[model samples]
Target: MDLQSDLPPLCVTCGVCCTDAFFRYSCVTPEESARIHSLGFPVEREDGREIFSHPCTRLCGASCTVYEQRPATCREFRCTTLSALEEGAIDRPEADRRVSLLRAAVQAVRQLLPKEEKIWALRARLYADPAAAPQTRLALLSMDILADRYFKLKGRRFFS
Candidate 1:
């Protein structure tokens, strides 16, 4: 049996953890690195470790295209929401509602920023200069707060 089959179904509908919203990169072993590279994904070496940036290229919407061959980090990491669901602490509908809210917030932030811009870069630009226009600053702040709430709800930490 596939171990992933036992995981909460919400994982297939939530891509927050894969979008660089929670983690900047996913770490991989040398073998996994080679596999990802062979699959045409861009991999980076940092501190002697292989890593892939978030908004992972293999992510197709809310699911991973390389699910069967995903890196260990991806396979092992579980958000609080998923844990809760697995333990029957929250029902599927509740999990879906939470994921939907997070997805809407993410979409709102994407709409507010340039289509090609990375979220971390936009966040840094907003943080580096407080002199940005009030509206822009407000939008960034709102996005930050929403992101924080999403992370908190997922039982994860917002690294920013």
Candidate 2:
């Protein structure tokens, strides 16, 4: 039996959650913080809670290097599309379609952004810059809409 094949393709191949696509930081328990820090990824303290910023160093082409030992948040999180697919609210094709759309949207935004600049920084700049390209603003909006609709939990996305 091919157990891996039975799993959702989007979760395995589309690792937007590991990137800066949706969130800036993920909350972790104190123990998770210690372990993740030991693994050489910097953990920060925020409002007495421990967090690790995204675009995770452990991600290598959509795969987590420390997947088995990843933080509890990483282990437990399920994007809205994944949840819908698992719950039979949407079929595999639809889930995959959503993933593809989000990926393309991210790519559009990435192409419009300056090299090495963070997405959040770009968003801030775009928001304040009156003369920014219309295409860039449109790309940002497309990415944000897809991320909000398919991945982010209600009221939980960055800059929401």
Candidate 3:
């Protein structure tokens, strides 16, 4: 049997975790770090640990290009929606709805700041400027609210 076929489809469509929605970087062991580097991913050393920022180079739009060879963090990480799905607390349709909502909100944020490379940087830029255009400010506020809602649904706190 194909066990993966029985799994929830949320992660297959949601790239938020890989795109730096919840974390700026993911840590990896030295060995995994070397492997990731060999795969051409940009890795950095922080406080004696190897880390990589998002959107991960290996992530190809909600899917990992190097899934089988992905680092332990990527292999093990699961969002709350995924957990809920696994436990039968939620069904696939509901999970798909939530993922869709998140994706829409993220798209809105991206549209507002098209040139920003990452979520953290976009948030920083928005927060740093109080005199931004009204539309920009409104977009930032909307993004903040959406991010909070997304994290809350994921059973976690919004970092920013």
Across residues 42-91, which tens digit of lDDT does each residue of candidate 2 receive? Answer: 78788888877878778887678787788898888888998997788987
- Which lDDT tens digits does candidate 1 get at residues 58-107? 88899877777778887877666667767878777777777887777676
**Residue 2 Cα positional deviation in candidate 1, in Å, after optimal superposition:** 19
List, residue by residue over 35-57, the lDDT tens digit for candidate 3: 78888889888888888887787
Once fitted onto the true fold, the runs of candidate 1 whose alpha carbons sit more than 4 angstroms away are 1-8, 133-160
How many clashing residue pairs appear in each of the predictions shown? 0, 0, 0
Error of 3 at 35 (Å): 2.3
TM-score of each: 0.79, 0.85, 0.79
Q: Score candidate 1 by TM-score against the native.
A: 0.79
Per-candidate alpha-carbon RMSD to the true structure: 4.1, 2.5, 3.4
Best by lDDT: 2
Which residue pairs in candidate 2 have backbone atoms (N, alpha carbon, C) closer than 3 angstroms, thus clashing? none
lDDT of 3 at 121: 77
